[model samples]
Target chain A: MLLEMLQSLPQVLIDGLALGAVYAVVALGYTMVYGILQLINFAHGEIFMTGAFIGTTFFILLMGMGWVSSVPQIFVLILVLIVTACLTGLLGMGIERVAYRPLRNAPRLIPLITAIGISFILQDVIRFIAELSSGNYIVTGPSLFTDQMTISFSSLSSIFNDASFKTSFLIVLVTAFILMISLDYFINRTKWGTAMRAVALDRETASLMSINVNKTISITFFIGSALGGATGVLFAVQYGTIDPFIGFILGMKAFIAAVLGGIGNIRGAMLGGILLGLLEMFASANLTLLTGGIFGAEYKDVFAFSILILVLIFKPEGLLGKPTAEKV
Target chain B: MPILEVNNIETYYGGIQALKGISVYVNKGEIVTLIGSNGAGKSTTLKSISGLAKVKTGSILFKGKETMNKPVHETCLLGMAHVPEGRKIFSTLTVKENLLMGAFSVNNKQLIEERMEIVFGHFPILKKRLEQKGGTMSGGEQQMLAIGRALMMEPELLMLDEPSMGLAPIIVEQIFDIIKKLNQNGITILLVEQNAYQALNIAHRGYVIRNGEIVLSGKGSELIENIEIRDAYLA
Candidate 1:
């Protein structure tokens, strides 16, 4: 029994990594926007869902129009996914301009309430559209990435019999890693990135430094919303499902991930998400085995929140967060 | 003609009035100071000029243009900078990063590099701690960094509020010395201080405010010798 459990390590680790990538991607949107705005874009979950719906609509429309006859031309799917994400990102900007801009100087609660309202409106709009076309509330998403490439060490291939799972998991891992590194470079090395960081630190001082504070904020929202859109597309591809309300749960999980990593710390969100994912998987798997089916896999979310609460009590700044001290 | 002019500016915070028609001016290259008690609106005058706080009724002219209603960043772009009371440096950022942020609007990298060198020349301590986080610095060091950061903007008129607010006597003297050097180098300054004696000593001209109104204005030496100023503010 012990040897079998030891043998299961790689597969379990791989499963955690793939899940973690999704959480990290979604969490980046939460972290980046929060870093600059200092307001939780509560509407962010709806933005993610909007991206998934737009991608699904694009895929369905393309298929209906007979855009591509060959199965190998699936690369077009990625293009559609990107376009959908971009559209949803623009929608996010529009919401900011219309609903949030006027209240920029108002109390923090005002924006938070407005964001919650916007979140509901987005969900209703998507659900209404879904109901009009199809009786079902759920949106049907197609599988665009069907082709798989497997990695094998001949001796270990027998032990890891499921080659397809490993291939797909590797793809998810590589894509997330590349995106995270690119975002890190974009924030630290670029001129605009530093400007954003400056604004985040001290708005009044940053303005006196001649930085266009409003423009920097708008750009931050755009980038964050764009990343959320991309995450939605990747999520649909990974899970083979898309729904209008998908962002609700994912957004909460991502927000929890951001808090667990350190709310305002950029790199912390990524680390926190991965760690949370592993902890969640281990809790469900190990608990089932140890407790003899008394506790089920659905309790993973409970485990994730328990860890979050523990971290909050012990290290509120998160693992890699810098403790801030006010200048008197 | 003055590079910046403020005439009868009244400002308020809800029901309380901070400034009641107070006026001050900055010429092409002269250090001016506003000296008063704690709640006498010395900082409010600077805040109003920088657009951090709005003026209810006033006419402010910068380079012969009206700037009373401009946003903080817009005023900054037009060559005005304010070193706020607390030396609000980006603590999480490095000393170099803080300096770089000061040049955010200037796209000229060459000019920024030139300015950075000048700032480093002015505050060698900042140059030594270029990679250090700003929050770790002592109060005196942060004050130097704040002034150096403002200098990076190359403002035509630099306004400082309470630069000596929380510093030791020696550090205060050093800061005032830097202000004198900066003024001699042709950067027009508007210095506001609760330390009336030190401000008057370094300033070319001074205004004494009480209850948000300017009760006296003249050459710094003349204000220093005034009986009422000596009794109320200098003491």
Candidate 2:
């Protein structure tokens, strides 16, 4: 069974990379918020869900207007993604100002509880909006990419199934990589990025340097949530369906990825996200064979969390996080 | 006109009063040092002028403008720079990045470059360690980087809190030499220091603070020779 799994590893790896790309994008939101404010931002998942819905709504509206057929497919997709990300970024900034800003000096637990509360509020609000519009909880995204969009790998088709490589997956992976690279550059090179890092390291000192701490934090939220929103658009396109409930599981898995990669570290989040996605795909694909039919794809989620628990116990600072010395 | 004027400012941290109606002022092109023991409200006084500490009842006039109600960054934009206590340099950032952040309010690239050149001239070691992280550097280097960062704003008034803290005597002497040169080059300075002798040596005027109040004020030479200052602070 192990040998058979090794033979199919390439296919599993490809699947994992596509899924991992999405998680890395989403995990960025969690990691950034935690880095500056030390808040979990549990509402981030709902923000992702809202982005998916926003993208779906725009696509459906465009299709209804018959613009999708006339416009280039790539243009429409990019338009949808940009609009969704901007709207979600605004929503994230609004949430920070209204909910988290007031509680900045409150105890850690207070803001955490507020974050969880915000999460539920966002889910219910999205659900209400959906029910009001279509009288249904689940929304089906428009099929943006048809068979013509598929990029076939004819040479590799003999080794792995044709289904393993798809144009949508390639688009998602490439877009995610571009976003990550840009984010890395923005955080490391830009003045605002330096301000963000300074604020995260020492708020008082950052202020003394004349950095507008509040503005820096608001921009951080904007960028982080925008990344999550972009990921949501890609997820909706890849899956062709989204609901308010979808954020719960996906968000939790992304959170696990963030924690696994060392929650406050940016590069760690990317590495952790891809590793978690690969682990999930491999476990679902090979576990039943290895265990002689005792475990199957149904236990894949459980396997992911079990690994999270094991990692937390053994390396709580995470795979890439340095153990920080607590200041007196 | 005095560059910075603080009048009877009372600042509190929660319920505890840190500054009790303390007043100090700095004139243009002068080094004014505030010497005090630990917890003597020296830092609090500096914070109040920079808008970091709330003034319950007082007025801080900077260049003839009421600055008590301004935000920290606003005061900074008005040509006031504070190199805070503990040398609060951004440890995770590179030395160059830390200096760049000091120029946060300035948008002119040429002016920033000019300021960078001036900073490098003052502390040539910082120019060599531009890519090094602030935290990994030696204490004296970090202190220089902190001062270099404050200079990036090209401020008219520079407020330093304990710039000589935790440095070797030779390094502290080097830092004091830079402070004197900066004042000579026409930047007003408000210095807070535990090393009263070194501070007063370079300062044109001085204030001796104790337990949130100013106990003595005079010329630097006079304060240096005062029996009270010699026994309480110098000794």
Candidate 3:
């Protein structure tokens, strides 16, 4: 039994890691924008959803245009996804420039409410498109990725014949790792990164240093939105479906991951995401099994939210975040 | 020509006036001082020049341009640097990053590198603490870093606001000496202080402010010798 459990640990860890990578990517959208603006882009998850929709639409359009036969489909999918990310990222920038920029000096709540409004607006926009195209509240799109690739480490030939959960897990792991490393480099090793850190540390001081504060803020939104966009596409591939409303819960969870890791710290978000994913997995695995099937699988969300609330009350700064004291 | 000219500027914090129509000037290569008690708006004047606070009714010309309403970055670009009171160093950044931030307006890497060398030469302490975080430094060291940061900008006029606010007398003397040396090196200065005696000793001109208005303005030596001003402000 002990040997069986030990072997299952890696499998559990791998599954948790895959889930965590997605959360980290989504959490970055929140953490990056928050670091610079000190505002939570509540609409970030929707931006992620928009990315998925954009990728899905491109895949459908490519298949419709009969372009799939001329080129490798995955290559075309990658290009389309990038273009979609750029578009969504630009949209996020526009939202910052128009809605949040005017209220830059206003009380924080006003912008937060505006963010919620933008979230709803994007949700409606996606729903409207879904409805207009299909005349239905639900959106149905062609799948860009199929779960054909699998890796199995099984002694039994029957088990080996069954497709393992490697493809979805691998895509999540690889995409997340590449995106995070590149982002870390972009933030640390570039002039724009220095300006970003300066703005995050102190906006007034950055402006005092003759750095264009407005441009820095806009670029932050742009990058954050792009990350969200990429997450959207990846999420669709992982889940095998896309929905306009998927962002609502996922955005909230990513936000929870951000808070768990240390909201302003970049690496913390990644850490938080993976931990949250594992916590959910363990809770679902043991707790649902222990209650003799009455507790059910849906309570997993409740467990995750309960953890968030408890963490907030006990350590408001999150796990790795330092508690900042106001300077007199 | 004066590198900076502040003329009849009124600044207020929600109806209670902080600076009541204050006018001052620092000609090229001169050390001018604004000395006053707490709440007399000595810091306010420096803040106004640096675009930290709004000027309700006045004109501030930096290098022949009306810079009253320009934002902080715009003013910094026009060759004006401010070392604000309380040593507002970017605490999380390294000493090197702090110095580099001062040169944000200048994209020319060669000039920035030259200016950074000059800044490090003046404050060798900063060179040693280049990789250390700004907040971890001693109060005196932070003050030196603040001055070094301003110098990195290579401003025509450098404004120091209460560099002696919190420090040991020995550190204070060292800082004042550095101020004199910096002025000797041809950077115009507008020094603000409540320590009237030490400020006037190094200053070419001094303005004595009381209750947000200038009560006395004269040559630094003459102000130091005035019986009423000396007894009221200086020991």
Candidate 4:
């Protein structure tokens, strides 16, 4: 049993890394919205779901146009990714302006409730559109980057076996890494990025610096939601199947990743995401073996949440979160 | 004409009123101070003029343009800077990022650097701490950074809310000296302070506020000597 578990480790790592990349990108949306507004945008997962539908719609349309054969599949993916990102970004901004901004100064619970409401609205709207057009909300996008590749880990160690992944896995990893790195550069190096940070820190003071508080909030939503949307596209391409409900579970896991990393810290969210993915994958792959088949791999979520509870109890500031010291 | 003319401005925090028909003005090239006890509407008056607090009635004319009811960033673009209470610095950001925010309205990179140089001249310590996070600085250094930040825009009127608060007496004196020097450089100043004596000493004109009303207004020199000010504010 130990030898079998060891042999599966490499495969688990590859699959876990791909899933973690998705979680990392989505978790950034949670972290950024929470960072600026101190409000959890519950609609974020719905935005992710909407992106999947939008991406599939684009993919289907492109195939109908015969672009699937003429255009490189990679270029088609880029087009779908960009279009999905912009639409979802606009949806995010509209949600903020309509539902969140008015209740900004109201009781904190008010916005949280409104966020949940917006989430339902987005879910229903996408379901309606999908069912109306295709007779089912469950979508299976055209396969792209279906080619497979293998890594021979068994050559290095007798305990490890070869690990193989679809070419889409590399595509997912590269895209997510590019998104994360560019976001980091934008936040640290660009002028608007600095304004966003200032506004996040202190709104009234940021205005004194000529940073428009409302506009900055809008921009934050745009960027965060755009990343989520793009990640949704990546998810569809890798898994080959998507439904309107996929975002709910995946988004919940990503939120857990954010909490594990520190909700408002960007880098923390990224690290938390990838780590949670690896841990969850590892648990799912090896739980039955390790536990002598008493607990099945289905207990992976429970295992993930158990870790969250432990982190909350032991280090509430998270791995990279500031201690939030009260000033004298 | 005064560079900033705030006439009969009344502001509210929810249903509770904070400023009740409070009027104040600052002329070009002068340091005007508002000295009042805690919760006496000094900060509210500054907030009202700087567009942070909404005014229910009356108008605020800055640089001869009506800036009241406009957005806060619009007020900043109109050449008005407010270093709010407690030195509201972007604590998580570095000193350089903080200053970059101060020049947010300026599109010219050369002008931003020029403004940074001017701010550095006023608070040289900030130049050395450019990479340090704003929150990690000491109280005195934070105050200097706050003032230096306000100067980044080269505002026609600089409104400082308690620039001397939470600092040693010597640091307070140094800040007041900078206010005086800034005025001499042709920047109009509206200073609000709890330290009445120091504020009035540096101010060319001063207003005494009480219970959301301006109880007295006079030249800074006379206000410092007034029997009423001495009894109520001076220890």
State which candidate has the highest TM-score: 4
- Residues forming the 10-long window of minimal summed lDDT in candidate 4 chain A: A319-328
- Looking at chain B only, the TM-scores across the models are 0.97, 0.97, 0.96, 0.97
Among residues 3 or more apart in sequence or in different chains, the pairs in candidate 2 whose N, CA or C atoms overlap within 3 Å are none
lDDT of 2 by residue, A175-254 (tens): 99999999989999888988999999998889988889999999999999999988999999988988898888899989
Compare the candidates by DockQ and give the number of the best one: 4
Give the TM-score of chain A, superposed on the true chain A, for all candidates in the order listed.
Answer: 0.90, 0.94, 0.90, 0.97
Q: Provide the DockQ value for model 3.
A: 0.59
Off by over 4 Å in 2: A146-163, A326-328, B230-235
Clashing pairs in 4: none
Better of 1 and 4 by DockQ: 4
Scoring model 1 with DockQ, what do you get? 0.73
Q: For residues B3-50, what per-residue lDDT tens digits would candidate 3 score against the true structure?
A: 888899999988889988999988999999999888888888888888
Native contacts recovered by model 1? 0.82
Candidate 3 per-residue C-alpha lDDT over A1-328 given as tens digits, one digit per residue, 9 for 90 to 100: 3444343445556677888898998898899999898899999999998888887777677778775758865687578768987998999999998999999999999999999999999999998998798787455556544565644544433322222464656766888888888888888766787789889988876777888899999998998899889888878777767778999999999999999999978888888898888777655655556566777667877777788888889999998888886332
Please tell me the interface RMSD, in Å, for model 1: 1.3
Report the candidate with higher TM-score, 1 versus 4. 4
How well does each candidate superpose onto the true structure, as a TM-score?
Answer: 0.94, 0.96, 0.92, 0.98
lDDT of 4 at B108: 98
lDDT tens digits, residue span B1-235, model 1: 9998999999998889999998888888899999889888988899898888888998999999999968888898888889998899888888988888888877899999999999988888898999999988999999999999999899889899899988999999999999999999999999989888899998889998988999899999998888889666643
